[model samples]
Target: MSSPSREAILASASRLFGDRGYRSVTVRDIASDAGVSAALVMKLFGSKEKLFAAAQPDERLLGELNVPREEIGAALAFRVLMRREREMQEPWAMLPFTVQDSPDPEATRAEAREKYLGHIAALIGDTTPNRRHAAVVVSLMIGFGEAVRTLGLFDDWDFDEVVAHYGALVQAQIDACPVA
Candidate 1:
């Protein structure tokens, strides 16, 4: 059989990592899951770390939102909830470890954190007043994603319910803040 293309490999890897944590999976496992040879996996992605980075959905999420300043909060919450639901359908919840055992894990995590903060800042529109609150809101969203995955909440709950819950909470925060 012809070797699977790099795109195919990356797609498989993304699903696998999103379903199963990156640490628990092996290249051979990914190859078997993708119906390709281990050699092909190695050739396509230099290492597991590189493969994880390549498979990450961060860029995709950003692209989906276009980083619109006004609608960023709702857009981010919607996208995050959608991603969580999608990931929950898989056999495992592939939550990327912000902190890896790499030499520069702190730097990597800091960059990721900053990316998230920037998105929130665009949404809230007041760096001084909303920066910390936005971070809290994002963190809460991440926690909610994990909880939904862990409890299989999406199996019974609908998207509207999820959106309503998050929307109300976010709006409450915005309303509480003094208008500048």
Candidate 2:
């Protein structure tokens, strides 16, 4: 098992990176937040760049995609907007900041696009040859994520109402996709 200090460093880095962006955050800042020395952080993760890469949001969000095709929209909406229990410093919440400050923002963005459009597309079970519907749904979810995470939109609506409405819209896109 990993040592507790390592976990603390990782958690601290995740929150700091998300809050301050990669360029804005220093190794010393991470170490201070984690209650360790900067040298220790470097020893554990090697460098700031590697630490940032490791801190990117995990694939667990895709777990929501395990739902039935018809429910994919709601599942995605709930995952993106309402589900905030992961951690106080959830990496996903800082995605926008990381994308802006990462050393290779384009590459990071591309990786995310591939995961959301490719992996998620497959998980949605779009058996048809064309993936336009899946792509649209993925794009919509990205937008909703940005809105909720960065813009603070739609925070007032009843939870169920938002889920139902947003899910219905996304489901419309899925319904448009051709079946195998």
Candidate 3:
């Protein structure tokens, strides 16, 4: 099993990179947050760049699409919200900040657009490829995540209540989409 220090370094890297993006954070920053020395971080991960890559967020936000088409939005909402609690990072929720601060802004933006927004568009059945509705849904997703995780908007609220209400809102946006 990996040592607790290794896991701490990984979690610190994930949070710092997700919150501040790749360019803004340094090895010392991650090591400091993890309560370790920079040397140990380098020993474990090799380099800051490598550590960032290792800490990249999973693409599981839109994963596990076994639900009915009509219920996809709620499924997505539930997954993202739950992940915000269980996982250290929320790539979709943190995309804007990451993109804005990225050293290679164009590449970062393009990759995210293709992977996330494109997949979301497809999930919403925009086969005609139009994505206006899906974009709005993404906005709501980011907003909901920020409100809950960063701003603590739902900290005192019931988890089910927050997810259910937010899920329904996401579903409403999906339902508003023009059928392909």
Candidate 4:
């Protein structure tokens, strides 16, 4: 089992990395934020690069890809909304930090983008027309997720209302593409 200090270091690393991108955060910063010694972090994660690998967004949430087509829209909307609610809930919060020209390694960014796209494709299934709609769904979810978390544009709306509206939007995208 991991020690509390280790968990704390990781949590701090995730938060810092998510906020500042990979190359910008330091082991010392994570150590200080976790109230631990820098040596401990180095000992635990070896190098800053390794620590970042550990801090990369957990993709297990994609397991929901098994949801039926009828439920995928709501499931995805709910998942994105929940991710916005807490940094630990979804790795989506760190997406902006891992984009092109960012400090994140190219492989890491490509892997993340591919994985998310795969999840969308799985949700939308194998239909040729649905493939394009899957891209739209991915874009909408990312835009809406960012808006709710970073833009404050939806601060006035109730949470359930937001989910409903967003879910409807997602469903509309899905509905627009008929399955062959």
Whole-model lDDT values for every prediction:
0.62, 0.75, 0.79, 0.75
lDDT of 3 by residue, 80-131 (tens): 6688678657766677766676666788789877777787787887654458
Query: Candidate 2 — which pairs collide?
Result: none
Per lDDT, the best of the predicted structures is 3
1-180: candidate 4 lDDT, tens digit per residue: 599998898889887877676778888999999999999999999998788778766778666466667767787778777776664534555676666425455776677667777677666763664368877877887787667666767779887887788888888888776765
- Which residues of candidate 4, in runs, are more than 4 Å off? 86-89, 101-104, 126-130
Task: Tell me the deviation in Å of residue 39 in model 4.
Answer: 1.0
Number of the top candidate by TM-score?
Answer: 4
The true-structure Cα RMSD of candidate 3 reads: 2.5
Candidate 4 residue 125 C-alpha distance from true site, Å? 0.7
Runs with alpha carbons beyond 4 Å of true place in candidate 3: 1-6, 43-47, 128-130
Q: Tell me how many residue pairs clash in candidate 3.
A: 0
**Candidate 1 off by > 4 Å:** 1-4, 63-74, 84-96, 100-103, 177-180
Candidate 2 lDDT, 140-176, residue by residue in tens: 7767766666676877778778788988988888878
> Which residues of candidate 2, in runs, are more than 4 Å off?
86-100, 126-130
